[model samples]
Target: MPDSDLLLIGLGNPGAKYDFNRHNVGFLIIDELARRWGFSLSAGKWQSQSCRERKWGSRVLMVKPQTFMNRSGQAVAEFAKFYKIPLQHIIVIHDDLDMHPGRLKLVQGGGAGGHNGIRSITQSLGGNDFFRLKIGIGRPGRGEVHPEIPVESYVLSNMGAEEQEILESRFDPIEEGLRTFIESGVAKAMSLINSIK
Candidate 1:
């Protein structure tokens, strides 16, 4: 494939049990992208559900790995190898607990920040060089509900209605940020997305 071809992977666990969890924000974003771009990831392959579409004159492969969150790198590596997509041309979307709810960050070549899915991908790819679109799910604060809960439990929990509303309201901006990333590249995307409150 040409350098213009891109691979977009959304990290999430499979099965209905995880469909609405905070960690499944990547899956939600993938669904929104498909809806906006007119593609269906109904086909299963490479341990994922995938679809290809032409976007900004380049072929974009959207994939949701079914290998679960921890082993996501296996699916990502397989797809990247098969498509010959370079690390810079790959983008992974997943949830972030460090940022406040509804905030988004577009970053490149960074540490996993304790995210198991990202850690797996970094290890499998031999580096942390891929672009990431991180959707903030927020962490427990002092005196907040479940402040004593485990991080794993918090991430696996479903989003409250208010939190879901906040996320839904930012979908348009997130979509625009993704478009900017695909058209103008990661630096531009990071500048634009990180500027958003």
Candidate 2:
């Protein structure tokens, strides 16, 4: 009901059909955080399950939109305006096929690279001033397990067991990066996270 000091979004398609896909890593992280923090993840004013957490005096409102991935902009834009969370205070976590598995990148304002969810957010927010915590899923071709399945098919397909293993291993590290981002600032977070090899 009240504005949040921070809003973190994890982009992913809705429905059990996409629950295990690489692209749904964002959703997975959101769910995992809810489980770890003992948050109810109950429905809120914006029709999103908002998990509340306070770190460094910041009331972080984490949302995993029930809307399918591409329509993410609608939920994010509306919720942000309601809470008055500035673009700078918004961070999106999504899977990136360009980077190796378990890799993460922090970027601000750029092309969507065919990610409809990001594209929708950019369009809805009127610009790309927000930050993105990109989790790399690795390119499909060139000896990788996944192939370029066009944006739609690729994001919907389930992750292989091996891929899931990799993701399971990186969960804590991702959470740590988020913790640093919340306790410190993005610059400091990046400095601490970018070099994680």
Best by TM-score: 1
TM-score of each: 0.93, 0.90
Candidate 2 lDDT at 14 equals: 72
lDDT (Cα, tens digit) per residue for candidate 2, span 3-34: 33778898887778888988899989888877
lDDT of 1 at 1: 29
> Across residues 45-144, which tens digit of lDDT does each residue of candidate 1 receive?
7789999888876789999989889999998998888888889889899999888888888888888899999999999988888999888887876345
- Compare the candidates by lDDT and give the number of the best one: 1
lDDT for each of the candidates?
A: 0.86, 0.81
Once model 1 is optimally superposed onto the true structure by TM-score, how far is the C-alpha of residue 177 displaced, in angstroms? 1.2
